[model samples]
Target: MAKNLTTLALASLLTLPLIGCMTTNNVQPIATKPFVIDSETYQSAGKSQRIKFIVLHYTVSDNERSIQLLTKGKVSAHYLIMDNDDDKIYNLVPEGERAWHAGDGGFAGRTILNDTSIGIEIVNKGIQPQYKDALKDSELDYHPYKHFVEFDEVQIKKVAQLVQDIAMRYDISPKNIIGHSDLAPSRKIDPGAKFPWQRLHEEYGIAAWYDEADKQFFMKETQLATPTIPEVKQAFRDYGYQINSTAEWDKASRDVIYAFQLHFRPLKPTGQMDIETYAILKALNKKYAGRDDFY
Candidate 1:
């Protein structure tokens, strides 16, 4: 009887191990959490318009510094092409969503800039004071105090290539590509005079250009009559400038002139809209006469 009981006990122990194995196999695993997207992520808004323009700006901070500030801080961008030796491109903001670059501005009769455009902030220090941000001229210290940063040759190439990519991807027009300061002149002066707007226009076919073909015709038109305040205001509005027009001519005109200088002739930027500016605007207005088709 004892032997029989021992045999039954051993059999039960063997069956218990199999039961435990079966229980382990039957237990199901929990599902992982779904991914949450950042606000910067480009969620499809059902439709996308052809990219009209590429607005340019300067990051103002160094690559490492920019990364830190943008990552931790609330500030962000659609893309950041560095001015470093390597000149790598960093995309902080997605193309589908708007980036917080253009604060208050108008373009081609459009307002509230963030939604309609893609901003590219190249690493640069714009309009630095003569004594400020100067590097110590020493190789030992990587970052000097107040080192004025400018876009290097490599940086420009990187910008061109990336701009080309964006232009191609979104069908961005060469005429529409512009700078931040172009749309919002009263408040900002960035991607400043030292940065190359002409090269982008002349070489890369970015932004409006004063084509040689229209030079004589434009000159004749400007010389025909002194443009009146209302006419000037109308021209500004027709070209997508944001001005009350009720404001004094000096203030309103300066806004338009500043916008022009930032995009075309950044070197002098006196905001006077001299004969050179008058000619440029006439050319642009002629070129973009039918932008509603795209917008």
Candidate 2:
């Protein structure tokens, strides 16, 4: 009976540690701060849609890398459209959440667009390697070599469908559909010259397009009297570019012009204030200037 007691005591000692370990592992510490839930019977009178703009971009990398970067890295996009033969469109982030695609940019009268924009990242090598090399040499102009790969037709169709659905749901304006470069002229140049803005404008009505007759008339008038730099800068600002209304044709002004030409006169984004570029700017501003919807 005494030997049995000794064995039982040893077993209890061993079991006590196991029991303590189990208790330690299973129990979770309670939070110190108190959280309360509240219910309201009445709703606020004034509210608006969180989403205001749809900003487009090109990943400048392959589809796989683009996905990995956007998902795992600090930068992210709401949607990523692949350039593969399949033309797959992937949703990386939910529409309700803000994506980090438009890092530091603005449009219309609003700054920091990431707060109010949905970003779409399309897979495309923004510039060919040879073209990039030629650009550094100064011996080659962008006209000869293809600046970017053409977007697949199926991909564009899918984008249009997605845009249409989102626009309908959020009541986004056609003018608010813009490229990343348009918002961040100083920093970004994605959804570059090759992006089919005209096609999107004509077919899907995603963006605004100026009338051809008006553009031609303005182009002709520029020959007689070139508008001052300040006038052109104000026109650009009125068209929603975040350009300073400086009288001089400074570097900042040129950069804004580059962003404009990259969207409108893509073949030659010379960054110079020329007749064609000025005409397009004037036409766009004349149509969209001082609209209450933009802000």
Candidate 3:
């Protein structure tokens, strides 16, 4: 009887793991609707009106979720660039009709943006933990938007190429192509610092770039040091950036900083001015002023 009891105990223990692996009636896959439209008149901006901006953003969700949420889920974009390992892009919203991306956005002294710009939401998290030295995506399981995101290199290359393609087609000046935070500073922060703006500039030249020398601090000592508020403000203005220049800093200022960091100094984006940022600003300002033949 003792041997029989022991055998039963072992069998019960083995059954626990088998039961764990058993298909539960509760965990079945939910059916996803095939979200599609005729895709008619998607990019039909007329000859009279102009395409002024190419706003960049991160989906903050997995590509699949992004598609579901944006198109089928009411929120949408003129273009949804899902550049994961597969390097795919979907045009969920038509460019001419103003996609629902850039929710409550503004830019260049204007309070409205969707009417003048094309929105592209890339699939990315675009945030880091409070004080961590680096982004640990593997540690992410609880974020509201990161439940399905798995970003990689292919996504980036596709972003640059797609940005270049759209900008060229619409005759949007490189300076006009900006991130979503650039448009609505106080309200949004997607396509955060980890994004490779420099790579886009170097490989595709879609956005602005500074002298590689300006990327490091010591390498650029005499570079645009002590730039006056007027100078900084003017530089931002020339690039068509909006600035409040308030007595007390507000959310709008931080938004522009987020935008600037996404474009230039993406690694440590506190929106605080540093040597590299100053040089890049000065260089960009000078470029717009026709100081450089390239500009």
lDDT of 3: 0.65
Best by TM-score: 2
Model 3 root mean square deviation, Cα atoms: 19.6
What is candidate 1's local distance difference test score?
0.69
Which pairs clash in model 1? 109-240, 133-146
Candidate 1 — which residues are off by over 4 angstroms? 1-51, 131-150
Q: For this target, which candidate reaches the highest lDDT against the unseen true structure?
A: 2
lDDT tens readout by residue for model 1, 170-214: 876665677776677776666666667678767886556666556
Q: For each candidate, what is the lDDT?
A: 0.69, 0.82, 0.65
Model 2, backbone clash pairs (residues 3+ apart or across chains), number: 0
Mind sharing the TM-score for model 2? 0.80
lDDT, model 2, position 250: 79
Clashes of each: 2, 0, 2
For model 2, residues 1-295, the per-residue Cα lDDT tens digits are 9999999999988767565557765776566675655558667767778898999999888978988999999999999888776746789899999899998778888898889989999888888866766667685433231666677787788789888888889888777888998999888877888888888889888777787888988998988898888788878877888988667877777778888888888888877788999998888777765542633
